[model samples]
Target: MIRVQARTEQSRLMTFASPLLAIVLTLIFGSILFTALGKDPLQALHVLLIMPLSDAYNVSEMLVKMGPLLLCAVGLSLCYRANLWNIGAEGQLLAGALGGSAVALAFGDSESMWVLPVTLLGGIASGMAWSAIPTYLKLKFNSNLILTTIMLNYIALYLLIWAVHGPLRDPMGFGFPESALFSDAALLPVLSDSGRVHLGVVFAVLAALVAWFILSKSHLGFKIRVYGADEPAATYAGFNANGISWFVMLFAGALAGLAGVAEVAGPIGQLTPNVSPGYGYSAIIVAYLGRLHPAGAIVSAVFLAILYMGGDLAQIEMGIPIAVVGMFQGVLLFFLLACDFFIRYRLVSSRETVA
Candidate 1:
């Protein structure tokens, strides 16, 4: 007979090894998927993985996607670490973009250097404001944060749609649901004239460093870890649970908001109905894949960014469906979860000598 049993102690080595195993499993499953679809598995894999890193321009584009993913994932990591489920980051991101767009539209012709800073601040503030809704509900009514946050995403999306279609619509855009192009001074500075990469990449790296410091070397981080590990112990230790909840939610919202503004200022340069291709949602996966560590998130963000670029490349070159990207993400998450389970439990075999 074979059975599974819990480990006497957590496997320290497997804690780090699980992610690698998950990657290997994901690749195997992906190849099987390609074969099942009647496609050339090797060629499909090449287009989905290798083609995106084959040249300078592709690399630059991949980095462009990486910036937002890294920023949002780092923020999500903080919230996850504290056991705060702020799943409405997508909503917070939209709120940030909306706030920044309001500023950009107001300063349509200004060449002031301060416009960019003010716009970023506006985004950050708006994100926090949006997050406050769920925070308040959780505190006052003891509401379920997961449902509130997830539902808030739709509210934010519709609010964005309404803003672009009604108040912020560009007159010259022929009824399109988009705002006017932002002034040059309001846009993020470009890193290279030949490519789309921008200064936001610098911000992403800095945010990761800051996150590492906060989570690893700060008193607040210690409290957060304690809270996550044992709520009753945290309460006994005099750590405020409500304070941690509020702080993490706001902090996560701020970073997500910054990511939203960076997307518009760095790449799109305008307020549109679609400011994100689900970066906020995808960041959740990046956060978990990185094991909720700041440095890990940076690396995972790059990997996820490559997946984004590769998905597009595959669709264009191999004629694969765009939905494959989501499938790949789901597969990766599933495998990671399975690996985590194995890390905590082991299969054992036992037999009777003469049953």
Candidate 2:
């Protein structure tokens, strides 16, 4: 017989090294998997990893992909820190894109600077409203967050599809399921003349910085930590658990909304049925890989963004499906969770324990 035993004390070194170990293990597993598929593992891994950073142009593209990831991850890290388990960042992001596009379209051909900010705020507000529903259900009716949020993701996707097909459809493009091109003032500014990198990257990094300060430097952060650590104790100590939940959820929604709007307003240049290639969903792995730390999300986001670049390269160069890239993410997350489990507990024989 076997039993799982909790460690007497946490492994500080493991806490820092677990993600590293997981990455190494994932690489090894990936190599074996590629070989089994009759592909040269070294070549496969090269295209998936090294080739994405082999050129300046590719690097710029990677940064573009990283923007939404970093933005979404920062918000998720905070919500996870509060133990809120809000899984609707994807929905909030979609809502933001939808909301921001509505505002941008409403402005028509006008080139006013205010168009950008107002459109962005509309996106943020939409995200907040999207999050409010699940938060309300959880607090008021004790609904399961995972289910509600997951359901909302599908709802959000269908709604976007409906909008682009019916209301926001481009009237001039012969009925394409897309909105009209946003004006110059409604778009994010490019960071440089050389590539598509834009102001969204700056927003993502600034969000991480702000989140770090909130989690590490504020009185509210302390209360959040306490509430997450022990709800009964937090209640006894007069911390408002409900307020913390609302704040974290809303904050997460705002950032995710910004990510959604920024995608259309920055790179894609218009709203569509697919504003994201699953950045909000991917950010969940990124949050845990970062160990729920704001700064850590930056590193994880960059790595995942590289994976996105490499996935495209791999499909073009090696005939690998893009689905494989998502599989890698799922595997990496599984390994990270397994490594984290070992860091906190160990298995022992029941006979040994009895003795």
What TM-score does structure 2 among the candidates reach? 0.95
Residue lDDT tens for model 2, 224-264: 88888888999999998899999999999999999999988
- Give candidate 1's error at residue 103 in angstroms: 0.9
For candidate 2, give the lDDT: 0.91
Model 2 scores worst on lDDT over the 10 consecutive residues at 191-200
What TM-score, over all chains together, does every model reach? 0.96, 0.95
Candidate 1 Cα outliers beyond 4 Å, as residue runs: 1-3, 348-355
Tens-digit per-residue lDDT, 125-146, candidate 1: 9888888999999989999989
**Model 2 misses residue 201 by how many Å?**
0.9
lDDT of each: 0.89, 0.91
